[model samples]
Target: MGRVLLAAVAFAGVAGTGNGLMGQDVPLAADFPEVYRVGGFDAPEWAEFAVPPDVRFDAAGRLYAMEGFLGSGSVVVIDTDGTLVRAVGRPGEGPGEINRPTGFAVWRDGRLAIADMGHRAYQIFGPDGEFERFVRAGSVSDPLGGAGSMGSKLRPDPAGLSLIAQGPPSGVGALTDLFGELLGAEAPGEERVDDRGLERLDLRGEAVSREPILEGWRPSTAGAEPPELSLDDLTEPAGMLTMMMSGQRWFEPGFLWDVLPDGGIAYSDSTAYEIKVTDGAGRAIRRLSRDLHPEPVTRRIREEVRERRLRDLEEGSDLGAGFRAGSGGNEIPAGIREATTEAMRTQIEDREFHDVIPVLTALRATWDGAVWVERVGEEPWVEFGPIDVMRADGEYVGTFAPGATRMPDAFGPDGLVAFVELDELDIPSVVVRRLPVKVR
Candidate 1:
């Protein structure tokens, strides 16, 4: 049995730093140690998972572990202590089958909602792992063709609705870069444009309402240099000769905002660390922030990140080569292949690092209604990074560490569920770690 913890601890006086913000900078009362761990090197005789990227806990605390990519994976259910209970659904295009399973939302009625990438739908499944029905997700025209509009995060409401972010295809320019550039054709960017924002969907998958959330085009970057290729870069023959360029608005407050339990909004913007909580009418109700500053991305930091990037590329290339050797090489045209490789190489070798990191990298609201804000550490990739826990009323709790034993993917009433991946084989197993009562 996993240890159940007090959702929050009492702390002394701490003041909010910014104007219109409610939370104070409540530092930890003591060191946050791991109280329990559920997954490890040991595997159950019944199951072996590959690349389980998403994990969720249902109302009953049964863990749902999704392994493999969106279009090809299985959802494995396990007990709180990492015992394999059953595996549900396989990769396919049929009913009950999921091609790409990206996100999960637990319905108030105790059913599971899955955001399927391949099917362009939120496939609902019963607690018994039986296929219910597909709530169809909307699609948009990408440069590659039609693409799903649902983002990865899914939040369920008590009113029989699920909240999700909707955006254009992340890689909308890929096909345009290849085909349009090769033929020197100019394409307008209008059709690919989308009103990126929060979308509310009912159980049957009908979108009840859509709220525009993102503000202006303030791009935020950290380690990677600006991408050289724009949609126009490849299409304009001259741009092919020149370096291509691209940028992404920091995913912090804009697309990263969460729908609050009370049907409100809690989102951060690019200019500040504060989160503006808004009611349904888009009126600001409260704001949340802490007295923390972003770490500067110095030259040394850039070099270290560069090394990591290069190593990752090398490993990926090796994996690609190995796959090609086994399944025969890709049948891409030589001209396009050469051009794409050179373009990626140039960008990787010359990306400029942002001087300061984003204050908040990511945030999620727990079943207990506590907002978990992932602070950007000095070393972004370090294990056991600190996460600040804030109550629904915007009171700051202590920072908790998800160390090597617990890399949490989803949080529930009992604790957090992490996909403990085996280092050597990359096989994934589920872990549930109970939260500590006090930070210490």
Candidate 2:
């Protein structure tokens, strides 16, 4: 049987630092188990502090990871089997280094992209951990694009995309020579263009241009201050929302993943409720929504909304006085079929996600054909869920968690997995976990 832990010696004071560039975010915990799984990690001693932003495996199953001493701002590397390897970058603005490097992804191109939110740009590094170059997204009209979440697919889904949210919205621009000339355009200027085209790189550091890889492409609107809720609803659920906001912000994203060589894309949804698939051209191929649990409270409220709308539409006696057109001049008709349809869409796609978990930190693929996701604390005292295994077609294989933290990156998409721990100041240390299964 599974355990629910809400308090323990090491589970309190769970901390995370955001860019604070987005909307006001809150992280809080409700009820959780007290004694959870903590025996699978290989390095019991080194499993204590906050880890840097990421940890990944190497071709040889060696865990090459980055750890930050939180407030110290030091980034260290570790080898497989839980031994200190090297320390390269530190927290501060300097060349060949980083400032609050919050994200890392080992691309199929063999190079790694570390997102230093303090210093915006996808900083590329060679597999050997050498600083390569930076890829400037310049300004993306939609950073998430048809893509839905920041930690979408196997990485952090980008959410709460609003000019007011992400400071000044970034524009699309090439990371031209930091010291070069341009078409009289500012070094970084805003230009709303279509997909800047796509580049697929492999572990060998080879670059291949491909199309955007999300399907059923629709832009995202998750992180924006949720549209104003009705006063009564807000008054009623205020306590629940307030409590949840303290330890987690469902819309804040921490990482991202692109489809391999624009081949195909598969990823979990915002609420971690479904896995959606898309072709290279960014079209939704399929989706698998989980029925693991049905939430009754949320369902009841939505059902009431539907019933009220139906009563008004059928009888035309009660709600006619309250129908007022919205910004589009579409009046809120008593028989609001349009309103009802939108309401249903919101209930399924957005509103019903009260207890659903958001992508906590990162998502990575195992060397043996499975995906692993790491989150802060799903239940009290529990650091992570198990290494979730699924068939590429979206089958629920299984899950195994050694501790708390995002799914640490694996060097290759093979059998091994890495996990990390962090301290109060937000610095992180690395932990390594592996599968006995042979990764072919």
Candidate 3:
């Protein structure tokens, strides 16, 4: 069974230099080791993978992948050697049917806990892929007066399951909400905000306990102040309001976390090169650090990001023409659409950036008690980069260069790793591989 050492360790002292914490620099491997490709698009039709696949491995090394389209999806089970084991669930509202599954987790006993947006509940399936029961999650009213289910993601927990629920709005609120309140609509209750947090839910879906995990980036102005608005702004078009509220600061650091196989939580909450591992009760047990120089956000970098942002907006915007064509009468005026685009451009141009790029970009805990830390690449905008592998007990294994290795979408037992790949035609597939022994 997978286990993480729970012994507390001394916190490493910070370095006087702004570079990073005082620890050994992760040495990069000259090249990635060979891996066996066991599964992919070549699999049977019924076992084919889909876009945005969510995968997990049970204690016995079986891979369970969840994939589907708009209203349909299912979990495909595969053996360690790429053989299809079984398929579970279907698209429907009935028992065992899954509609719009957002996230899922595999229990040590091989049962599945799925977060279904369509059902607004957590559904539990037996080890034999039979639907057992579901727990209806709580809902919260948004500032715009629309209620949405709080559950979005699920994490494995020894006591039960960890539900990453949505929290309340921050920094004034969305422009749409402000407009609704100004128009004399009843405001959202304070109880909704108070209800927000990480909920430990039992199999019955009742909250056994609740606690705050970590905060994420909230919308704010360039000067770190809330946006000022006037009553006159209420008359603005919906497109403008939406665009104004959608802007996010460039390269802002947010919480990156994952649950270890032993129920310990591993997380990186800052821009520093530090990671903390805590037991199920949230007490710190180990702290990992590394020394390195952070890449500065230069003027050229800012300009490049701004250009890319603007280009993306232009490419994505249809000037509301498509909406008008489809919705039949609630069309956004051309002027409003143009103004929205301009507003977005301004937001991107004026967006503030951090002094240095965050030390790590992603964090994942392997089923075998290892944590993979994805470091920022030379180009901050690029998603994939080099990775630093370390054991749960704070032993820094080493680093893999971006070209030398590709981070697996899911890590499994016995040095097994799975990557969800896409073909030229956007056809999705799951490729399973065994990691090199030394790296594992």
CA lDDT scores, all candidates in order: 0.54, 0.36, 0.63
Q: How many clashes does each candidate structure show, in the order listed?
A: 12, 83, 0
Q: Which stretches of candidate 3 lie over 4 Å from their true place?
A: 1-43, 68-71, 139-152, 159-199, 205-247, 315-347
lDDT of 2 at 63: 46
lDDT for residue 90 in candidate 3, whole number 0-100: 85
Give TM per candidate: 0.70, 0.45, 0.75
Candidate 2 lDDT, 1-440, residue by residue in tens: 11111111122121122321121222222212221112122335333333244454445544434443232333344444445555445556765566655445543333455545555444566656677765433334323221111110122112211000011111111112111232222432321222212223222222211222222222243443333333233333232232223222223332233342234444443434444444543345554333332223345554554555456555643323223433225655444544444443333333322333343344544555444444434432244543343444454443444342245444343444554444455444444544444221
Cand. 1 TM to true fold: 0.70
Question: What lDDT tens digits, residue by residue, belong to model 1 across residues 1-440?
Answer: 11111112222233343332342344543233343344345655445543445666676677666654522366777665556677777878998887766666665345777777677677778867788887655323233222234545566755555554444433333433455455554553323323234445555544223444323233444553334565556554335533324343212224346666566666665435666665643455566767666666677777776677677665556224323233223464556545555555555566565556667766676656667676655476564456676765666665644442332566655554344545565555554556554320
Better structure of 2 and 3 per lDDT:
3
**Candidate 3 TM-score over all chains jointly:** 0.75
Q: Per-residue error at 159 for model 2, in Å? A: 25
Error of 3 at 436 (Å): 2.8
Which candidate do you rate higher for TM-score, 2 or 3? 3
Among all windows of ten consecutive residues in candidate 3, which has the lowest summed lDDT?
A: 190-199
Candidate 1 Cα outliers beyond 4 Å, as residue runs: 1-42, 68-72, 81-86, 139-146, 166-196, 203-217, 220-245, 249-255, 280-282, 315-342, 380-384, 401-407, 416-419, 437-440
